[model samples]
Target: MKTRSKIEDEYWGALERLKIGKTKVVDTKSTRFRITKDAVGREAGRGKGYVRYERYPLLCEAIADAEVARKKNGPVTPSSNAKIEQQKALKQKAISDYNQLKQAYDMLMTEYLNVVRRNFELETGLAEVKNVKIIRMPSVR
Candidate 1:
């Protein structure tokens, strides 16, 4: 088992390598960044086997630093602009979709309330009719 200090040293080393462009950050499926040794094509934080990078506080700090470095050094490209535009369009579409769904829900709720009101009125009318029928019943001698 490795000591905490050794693991922290590894993370700091990875961060230094990332700053110098020797290591690159790869995004995981979970949207977390992982530093990779570009020359070896393996992850930096992993010492011997699988290492959960989030377990160490230093590793998370190192990843955050690396991400900041990447953003600072990365060049703005045409593709990045296109991605921004795509995100904006998606956001607009989602807002429009939510508005439409909200309108439909409001209309349905109104109709439902009207139905319930009508049902209650009918039920009360039926009960009144039953009371009248009972009052009109002839007494048996």
Candidate 2:
């Protein structure tokens, strides 16, 4: 099995080729985790920007080596299953957040249109602004 540092080197090198910037790898007995650098590096032989695919293989190989190591040394607890669960929670939260934003935006847009329509009615000498209805979507679909 490859050493942890060797695996990390391979992964970072692959990322470099792929223009994925830099990453820092932390290794425990059972699993390896990579922390990507905040800043991305520029692409080679190009004008600007970074590329992700260039270094994918390098990262994959490093991860594969880590998995092999994990098989030999058992699983890592705090970082493995916990991370999966955390990701799932984050995904659900994101969906909920998106729904909330969409609802707020819809309401605001409707109110803006209603205001405009009320202004138009006043300009055209109409009475009362009681025709607007904001309907909530049915919960069961």
Candidate 3:
């Protein structure tokens, strides 16, 4: 149990480096930036494309951290049925929260895609239209 707790602690620590809102620049393209674990919307630029981290990773990290804490100094040990039930409840809520976050990310991505697509179409259409002008000559004095 102690070993398991240590591993979970390490896993959680690693995940902290991958949290949402964290920004990193693309190694190859200085102008391109990647936002890790975005709960908002995916964005792309330069040579890069839109990408997002799935919520499952975050959920796993949260669960592992909680387990580590519970093992170290839980209110009760596994010998009690209530402690087991409490752990189970915590796991269920974590899963539910992950699902909700995933749904929100998906919705945001959909809106982002639609807006980009529409803008591209409009720009293309405008580009194809030929430029025209109407000019009237002023009378010479």
Candidate 4:
């Protein structure tokens, strides 16, 4: 299985490609969309169905930004233009907030791991153990 870091790297890379016009977002009949490469129109990410925001939030943000840019570049009324600008700002803020929360979560996880390691050392009387493995069990719903 791919590590979380690897998955996040792939998502961020795809989002960057989409932002720079290296990839394009294609909309389906349902309210779903796919990100495809510009060169050969190949799908960038995994899965056959429409991209889900819950799975790839950054990619979805990129797609929304691309759509807003497309609309702004084309013929648009003043009121609609203002709305688009508002939406863009809101999206940026949301991304910023999400990033901050993610960072906090990462820090908390690191602290938790350190505490666990210390506890293990104190209980087992092991000195300076460099490796600690954690096995997580599935939680009951």
Number of backbone collisions per candidate? 0, 3, 0, 0
Could you tell me how far off, in angstroms, the CA of residue 17 lies in candidate 2 after the best superposition?
37
Candidate 1, residues 25-82, lDDT tens digits: the string is: 4333333334433311234545443334446655555556666766676665569889
Counting only residues 3 or more apart in sequence or on different chains, how many pairs clash (N, Cα, C under 3 Å) in candidate 4?
0
- The alpha-carbon lDDT assigned to residue 55 of candidate 4 equals 65
Q: Best-fitting candidate, measured by TM-score?
A: 1
CA-only RMSD, every prediction: 13.0, 15.3, 23.0, 22.1
Top lDDT model:
1
Show model 1 residue runs off by greater than 4 Å: 1-80, 132-141
- Clashing pairs in model 4? none
Q: Each prediction's Cα lDDT score?
A: 0.61, 0.51, 0.49, 0.59
Q: Comparing 3 and 4 by lDDT, which wins?
A: 4
lDDT of 2: 0.51
lDDT, candidate 3, 1-141, per-residue tens:
323444334334433432332323223223332223221122222131222234245544464564465346533335678888989999999999999999999999999999999987877777677783434479999
Worst 10 residues of 4 by lDDT: 34-43
Q: Residue 120 lDDT in model 4?
A: 78
**Residue lDDT tens for model 4, 1-141:** 634556556656655664454554433322333333221123345544445667656556666776677556644445988999999999999999999999999999999999999987775654445575455579999
TM for every model, in the order presented, reads 0.40, 0.34, 0.37, 0.35
Looking at candidate 3, what is the lDDT of residue 38? 27
